[model samples]
Target: MLDFRMDTFLAVCQYMNYTRAAEALNITQPAVSQHIRWLEEQYEAPLFTYANKRLSLTREGELLRSMALTVKHDEQMLRRRLHDPGPGAHRLVFGVTPTVGMSLIPEPLARYHRLYPDAPISIRVSNTESLCAALDQGELDFAIVEGYFCKSDYDSLLYRREPYLAVCGAEYQFEREPKVLSDLLGETLVVREPGSGNREIIRRALSRENRAVEDFRSVIQVSDMNVLKKLLLLGCGVGFLYQAAAQPQLGQGLLRAIPLEDFQESHDITFLWRKGSVFAQRYRQLFELLSPQDIEGESCAAGD
Candidate 1:
């Protein structure tokens, strides 16, 4: 349980207006002011400042707001879990990024459902940042995220390494043999939105070669991978995507994976959960069910 004062502080930080925060809290403006003053006195730092009739958080206020939000979210999770144990309900909330959702999750999810027909699985797909934030705040039981290399307080395991490939329409022609990263400069490149792990990887890969995507003749940004694939199939541009994501299309003769000389780096995909959670046990069960050998191998062998 968090102090009610922290709630007031968070509301004020959100609205940045005393009157608005008071109204939201159903309290008097003076009371809001007093709460702010009390918090400031306790912390020995002013939380906000006023300049030219505009309100803004001071550095200390920003720090406090971030901490408060995490605390509030944790409290909410605790309350919800205590009130609704979710045991025997046979439901699990799994969070994932778009890339993982497209390429990796479906097969494992199908197998899990078949093995435990009574269990209902809920999936939340977003960018990597949002998924990680949700996991940290306890809003998700577990998550499969890419590019999480540093060890944190959470329990995690490296599930797979996704190799990247440069793909283009089958009909597209290139003057070079696709042996070097510099050969891609004049081609139109399609990319995901900023803040995405895929985008960051692409940026870093380019930067390390002393090159930049901006040097390309044209750049297109789209949030939907399907649309980007369509564009690539139509010979509109070249794009970078995980090999697993492009494998089916490559086999179907819709796209070609351009080989880059000496580019062998890969991104890590990890499964994450709260530290010391009972949910961790159940999550591991789910993980084993989704393991590539257990699920994908069996499926492939059956198909053959």
Candidate 2:
């Protein structure tokens, strides 16, 4: 179990206000202060500083916050397994970015479900940033994300390297062979919403040409992957997405991939779990179910 003092400290860190933390913890404000003072004395370092009427973690406080998070997760995991162990006793909660959720994870999740029909599963699909936040809060067991994140915070495995492609309606006629960013910039561009992995990937790729998404002639931001694909198919705009995601339309002669000189690159789809998770080894079988090589190899075969 996490220490009550540590929990009190975390509440303060979260709210950054002594009164608010106290109210949330159902404790008195002075008691909250006492707990913090005790913690500071034990650690022999001030954990927070009040400057300009704002509370902020000092460098030492930041270190303690990190350690506290790990300790909290360890305690939660221990309590969960201890309280619930036996047939059909565990609930697995995980997260995924929209791109991975739509294209890569369905089959493996289904297989896992079949194998452990009694173990309830909860999946949260959101942007990479949101997914990582949930993992940080210990709301998820793990997450599968695309684009880039702070890999140092978790234990991760590269599940797949998926290529991003420039796509358009099959009937849309290009003025010229698409060779550069300029060729596509004049057309309306459909892109993922901010914080989405696909949008982040496109943003970084555009920076190589000293451009940004705002440089496009017109931009359409769609939060749902299905809606984005629908817009592209209806010729609402040219879009960027994983090649495997566009495969179905490309095969049906309803969509065509426009080759880009600079944006032709792949990003990693990674599986992330809390660092030093007690359940890490226990969940290895889940990783085996979502193997990137196996998933993509089969996708390629189907495409061929």
Candidate 3:
């Protein structure tokens, strides 16, 4: 069993408030303080600092937190190994963002199912932040996320790099060679909500140019890319989307991909699995099926 004090320290680090941590642990505030004090005494250094009623981890605290996560993961793995039914069946849980879930996952998942018909599969569709957190918490066997790199402890490989395109109804008109960034300020922008990896990418790109999302005249905040595409087809507003995702609408002349002078960049879609996970082989097989060459040569070839 892991040390109880270490568990308390981990909880405190997560919540960043001793009172809140105590409440979460169903213990008294003084008990939380006592655990921290005991841990500090054992380590011979302060783990955190409190100032102005705000708490921040000390350098040592950050290191300890990382170590605690590793310990927790290892403990969980041990428990699973001891309790798991031997060679019967297994379920794999995959996490994905909505955009990738819609555009990229179907074919590979279908292939995986055909190949491993006995293995059960579960999927969780969420924003990138939630997907990453789920991966950390050991709730997912692997995840496919957009625009973010996996942490050092996890093994991550770039699965796809798809171009982001400015999309709008085919009827939308623009001046001859209009400035992409400047002209977008006047248009009604339809964008994903904050915390989405797509939105984060846009935020970072705009930040480089000393601009922000508020600078745009946004008309809608959508949660799903498919819904956004539907709205764009209805001539509601312009939005940014992965070229592969917008290809169908583009083919039907329901929407057009506007050429952006400086916004011609690709969003890297990454496949992530926990370091030293037992399901690594299954994840690798799935990744090979999802590899760009395989996917591009398969049913979605024309779309790509």
Report per-prediction Cα RMSD to one decimal: 6.8, 5.0, 4.9
Local error of candidate 1 at residue 167 (angstroms): 1.4
Output the better candidate (1/2) by TM-score.
Answer: 2
- Local accuracy of candidate 3 as per-residue lDDT tens digits, 1-304: 5699888998898899988999999999999999999999999999999899899999888777766665565565456545545554444567888878887888777776776677667799988878777766656667888856446456676677788888889987654445566678777778888878778887888888898878877668888877878888877777888877888788988898877788887777778766655555666776776555533322211113
Q: TM-scores of the models, in the given order?
A: 0.73, 0.84, 0.85
How many steric clashes between backbone atoms does each model show? 0, 0, 0
Quote the positional error of residue 108 for candidate 1 in Å: 1.0
The candidate maximizing TM-score is 3
Against the unseen true structure, what C-alpha lDDT does each candidate score? 0.75, 0.80, 0.75
Please list the residue runs of candidate 2 whose C-alpha ends up more than 4 Å from where it truly belongs after superposition. 11-34, 49-56, 74-85, 88-90, 292-304
Clashes of 3: 0
TM-score of 3: 0.85
Which residue pairs come into collision in candidate 1? none
Error of 1 at 3 (Å): 2.7
Cα-based lDDT at residue 110, candidate 2: 76
The alpha-carbon lDDT assigned to residue 130 of candidate 3 equals 82
